[model samples]
Target: MRHDSATLIILLAVVALIAWFAPDVVLIVFAGCLLAVALRAPGVPLARRLGIAEHWGVMIVALVALVALGLLVWFGFATLADQAREFSRAVPRVLERAGTLLEGLPGGDWLKGQAQPEAVQPSARAAANFALAGVSGTLGALGNALLVLLLGLYIGADPTLYRRGALALLSPGLRPRGEATLNAMAHSLRGWLLGQMFGMAFTGVFTFLGLWALGVPLAALLAILTAIFGFMPYIGPVIGAVPAVLIAASHDTSLVPWVIALFFASQNIEGNFLTPMVQKQSSDVPPALLLGAQALFGTGLGFLGILLAAPIAAAGMAALRVSYVEGWVEDPADTDEKRIIRPA
Candidate 1:
């Protein structure tokens, strides 16, 4: 028992060391795993229906997705770029207006003092760069993207090979439990991804129509931002609404409320209707828990972590349920027989 405890401690220390030193690589690999599951989720069923091999199905789906995304970027890139530039130009003026408004309010002086920008120290700059390394527009980001794509393709093609290899690391008696835990984790991730994808689509479409109807400037850009931020769950929608609100306020104060209402309604629809319906396959992981994980992972692992946090939290919940709750915490007599999830 002491030996086992020591071994576990050593293993944990090693993992921590690796995480601390190679967080970007770790996150990229993690991204690949989630992408594999997401791609395979629809691929397998489609493959069976069309009498095609699983790998071929996955390749087709992935290629189609890539082609669609490429086309979107190809067509929308100019408009997105223009909107981005316009937003950048508008931000300072908006901030100045906000600053003016704050100056007229109580505690205005204190707020202004607090908001003043200080020169970034060298260490702080380094830390900032490290945090942003995953999307730094450097070779690192490209390399990570390529790595994830290759890993996803290989893993999605024949996930069982990787699964068997992972299971082989455990003792013969523990292999079954390990396999079960991994399967549960994958299912949880797949469900979470599906739900999130649907949520993003719904948020984007709703936001676009509402903003366009309201004659908001850069409606498409804001809608895309809304969709991208949807991945971050609770806080994301709020952050996404900021630019729209600022731009609207710049135009007309009356438009500000309309923008706010638009976002509020969109979020309501997503949180109340879209998420619950899609997340039926995903077991409940508390909202508070997910938010906490997002905070922690974002702090530790940066943007990629924030993007993937919901699924990560879902997988964590599944692991805890399978390994700790069912395996040891609950009485076996009271527990229902759990079925192992198999690859399709």
Candidate 2:
């Protein structure tokens, strides 16, 4: 199909504005849809047990999931807020320990003389701030999140509506292949969500266990950080571990280096084995391309782009397979991809 220049420009501008205005909402909606996909299987059992219709059953589960998520956030934030207060009071000791440990490194002599970077202590701007940050975050954005939450419910409870609506809007010649693409895309998204949650739980448990064993303070709060960061796929390991290292550094100067190194080691293990293996059972997305997309579109879409990258790629894979392999369209340059579809 020939692309329209004006139309393309308009679309790009709209997308850019949306990305700028509401990145968080978009990612939340994407996440909610993914969660719905993951839970679709259990809807059947839930419906039977609750004596509700399929759609209602799905909504029930979705709300329950959202509520549970909210409660988890509430508790986690509360815990972190408490930790921050305690940590702030103990900042001098932590800084002294960190400086002592840093002095042993290659640049130790110069570093120990200087002050700890405020960077290590999360500033008001950083998300690691106290629950007090939530009020700032919600200022005018609460409505957007609520809208996305509602949209997610409608889409999740009966995704087929959107699929059919989208399929109907496609060119007649492309509808059959598009349907196939949607099916595959949904499956891949569902699998990715399942794998993601599983990976998060695994990471959280491992981090908590490691920190607790090492006697790190605020182990629960640190585990939550690990799990939340793990949402970003390959980038999560480092993001999750940074605070833990700093917090640990603050506690015992001698243990800082070991703690940092161990965090990296655990991340390596999870990336190389746990996450990939679980995700592989769901779908096969190459790590190189995943990271590349994260870097590229992430610049354009920020966190929303990063979160949606894998799902979009999964959809593209489905389209390519159904269009070329299933013979829905002809690839003029490659005879191998010529596909014929007969109307029913």
Highest lDDT: which candidate? 1
- Model 2 earns a TM-score of 0.73
- Residue 91, model 2, lDDT: 69
User: Where is model 1 poorest over a 10-residue stretch in terms of lDDT?
Assistant: 113-122
Q: Over the stretch 46-140, how does candidate 1's per-residue lDDT look in tens digits?
A: 89999999999999999999999999999999999999998877765666555555786899877755543332224867978876884666777
Taking all chains together, each candidate's TM-score versus the true structure is: 0.87, 0.73
**Candidate 1 backbone clash number:** 0
Encode model 2's per-residue lDDT on 1-344: one tens digit a residue.
33333443555587679867987655676666665575565674698898987778777777788899899779777778997788677666766766766766898877776646553556655645665578876764677567666776677677878878866655665565566666666666666666777778887888888889889887877888888888777777777777788788777656667778777777777767776676675466777877887887688777667767776666556556655555436553454323322110
For model 2, what is the error of residue 13's alpha carbon versus the real structure, in angstroms, after optimal superposition? 12
Instruction: Report the Cα lDDT for candidate 1.
Output: 0.82
Error of 2 at 176 (Å): 0.8
Positional deviation of 21 in candidate 2, in angstroms? 11
**Can you tell me which runs of candidate 2 are displaced by over 4 Å?**
1-32, 39-41, 48-51, 70-80, 90-136, 261-265, 324-344
- Which runs of model 1 end up more than 4 angstroms from their true locations? 1-17, 106-138, 331-335
